[model samples]
Target: MKKILIIGIVASGKTTFAKRLSQKFSLPWYELDSIVHHNTATGRYKRSAEEQFEIIKEIDIKGAWIFEGTDRDSYQCLYQMADTIIFLDTPLWKRKVRILTRFIKQKLGIEKCHYKPDIMMLKMMYKWTRDFEQSRNSFDAKLNRYNEKVIRLRDSNNLDVTKGTRLS
Candidate 1:
């Protein structure tokens, strides 16, 4: 696909999958988290919504790109420009395990995350994973409004980045 949008709850493998897709297709990939969070001498701070919109607009005008994250309201224009959208509908239990594992790794300095890992971040991740089902409905509705091919990968095994064809 020329342009791809990967959306999912935090720690649901969006970044991982997008990276794979980017490598497979030889297209650049952008992690929305990295764009939104700016590291300063003080601490990590988010860019203004207008700034985020401008950044996304620049990416959308590129020849091809794969963007991973969920900020539908802010990146609606990018969503419209995407040729394909892949939704990582991973189960809650798996998401919980991933979130916890990632937190431990980041805390131990074994893994680097876009944002620092802390107790507050961990708690927020847990709550997001627990309430993901409710958020999923809104994602579905948004996807329904777009005509681009949307692939819902419910399990990790279902995604085959090597296969260029869109999943039915």
Candidate 2:
């Protein structure tokens, strides 16, 4: 429960769950995407795999943290480092709706995003979600190694932050 890794596809509620869990435990949270794509004084740039690993290691030294993002080969080590892993298995229909809603919000300037909220990005989100489903068997196999520490959630709201437990 100390070091948590929340992994999910786009619009799977990883960020929301991480925020709630972090607040409940008074622990710092991080977006893995931010680590991969470093934002600097000049602009955002994708960091080298080695640089990303260094940043992750620096954060790991802090003892406890919540890192959330879609799975990436660059940070596969997170699975070994995390004390717990949360896989937000939100329904495909819900996630699809969320993707559209999120895009609308971002385009309307009601929501913030690190990347551009354009048609291409929206298309990519859907593509990623489909790809995730196609590759879920492999992902599940990878997670099987850490089954004891992994919690699968179909709905983020079903988690009881106060008790750090799942309600259903």
Candidate 3:
């Protein structure tokens, strides 16, 4: 409830959920991508793992926070510190639709992203969305070892961050 970590595949609505949760709970929110993918004059580039860990450590020391991202490896420390973990188990079809829509939005300059949108990025996103099942299996395995309360949200429509309720 205090320190929350949200993990899921690309376009799984992690950012949206985190924003809603942050507003509802009045907790600070951080997006891991913004930390890892530092915007530069040449575009976005990932920070070194050591640097990323250092930044994450700073965030982990905070009293309360809600973080969203898929960097379980670099942010393992934060994962350990979080009190609740939310895994968005959204359907692949829905995720695909979201990916396409978001890509279009970014291309049209209507939506801003941590990284610039390009053909290669779009292709990578599609591949990532397609391979989500495997990634989720790995994520679940890692989470199985953690004792924190984990919430798996399968349907976006069922999620109510304000009330922390899930409708069937």
Candidate 4:
């Protein structure tokens, strides 16, 4: 209802869905990648974990906003700041399709990372999604402590999120 944080694997639609949520709530949309990639180039500039967290703290200090991304402890730097936390846990194959599509799109010049997203970057994201251990991702820890406020979406098609609640 207030601050919302989105966590998801690569190509899980976090950015797109976050935009929708922003419109639905009439709140400003904050794409972590966008800010993290700002002033750099497409897909090339990535902020360090420390800098990322700093931004989150800055956002929280400024008050209510919708944040969308994974792997930022800065958002968690101010835990209890978010009213709802969304976890987009799509299937590995679905993610791979998305990743490849993004790659193709970027490579085709339809869109750029604002920097660069080479094969290695894609591989890392793919690996993270395919083999990401829930226990390993910081989101898992935040989730465990805030399960009541968490919404888990297991499918890429969003079969589990409904009526403003998590179905499963």
Candidate 5:
């Protein structure tokens, strides 16, 4: 798709899938994280809601992009800009394993992670998904009006959000 939006829970592989899609489609890839946040000490984006909105508003105006993120930000501006939404609803256990595994790799210097992992950081990551801090569920009720626009994937290993399930 020319204008695709990739969304999912933290550690659900949304970013990885988005990059793959970009390669497949041969289109420009845009990371919401890059535009919406500043790097923390450990190379993690320091989130700022206002900044995110401003950036998304500008980016949406540009149109024609493949944006990726897990946060269910109700930027009607951003949603209207996207032609399709891909929701990656990976299982909880898999998500945890992905997080822990990445943490271990980063800690061991086997692989570089975008963020640092400490006990508190791990707790935040767990909470991020559980509380829908950066997920589709956060905008479930509000986006109900836009069911026609959504592509909900409640279960992992689904073909498509529309075929898999409807959030509202």
Candidate 6:
């Protein structure tokens, strides 16, 4: 795929999948969170919706890219721009386990993260996951608009790069 968007909630393996896809396709990958909360000489700050769209546009001009992140209203335009949209629909129980495991790893310094791996952040991760499920209908409806280009994966491990994403 030329332009890809890997979308999912917290701990859904979007980042991992995007990395693999990018490597296989020899494309650049971006974490959308980095765009939303931009780092500067001063500190990290949230960009406005307009600014976020502009950044995405700039990246679009550079050619193929794979962007991974939870769905956000600010960057909804990416859906229309992408050649492929991968939705990681990992199981709820597995995601819950991953959230805890990730927190433990981050807290123990085994895993590096952009933000502090505090209890609050862990709680927020779970909260976001729950919120995502509650609003899945809305998300699915949005996804339907791009049904021709969408691929849903229950687990990233099951994907076979050699066979391509369409293979079961």
Best by lDDT: 2
Kindly list the per-residue Cα lDDT of model 3 for residues 1-168, writing each as its tens digit: 899888888888889888887887899999988887888888778898899888877877768899898755776877678888887877788888998899999999999877769989999998877676757666677777763466778764545534332322
Error of 1 at 152 (Å): 0.4
Error of 5 at 163 (Å): 6.3
Q: Candidate 1 overall Cα lDDT vs. reference? A: 0.78
Residue-by-residue lDDT tens digits, candidate 4, 68-159: 88755444553477887788876667778889899889988997665467898888877777566544565566577877777877653543
How well is each residue in 47-79 modelled by candidate 6, as lDDT tens digits?
999999999999999999999999999999999
lDDT of 1 by residue, 5-33 (tens): 88888777888888777878899999887
Task: Report clashes for each candidate as comma-separated counts.
Answer: 0, 0, 0, 10, 0, 0
Task: Name the TM-score of candidate 4.
Answer: 0.77
* Clash count, predicted structure 4: 10
What candidate 4 gets wrong by more than 4 Å, as runs, is 35-51, 133-142, 155-168
lDDT for every model? 0.78, 0.90, 0.79, 0.71, 0.69, 0.88
Error of 1 at 110 (Å): 0.7
Candidates, ranked, lDDT: 2, 6, 3, 1, 4, 5
For each candidate in turn, the TM-score is 0.87, 0.94, 0.87, 0.77, 0.74, 0.93
lDDT, candidate 5, equals 0.69
Candidate 2 lDDT over 95-130, as tens digits, reads 999999999999999999999999999999999999
User: Candidate 3: which pairs clash?
Assistant: none
Worst 10 residues of 3 by lDDT: 159-168
Reference-based TM-score, model 5: 0.74
C-alpha lDDT (0 to 100) for residue 44 of candidate 5: 52
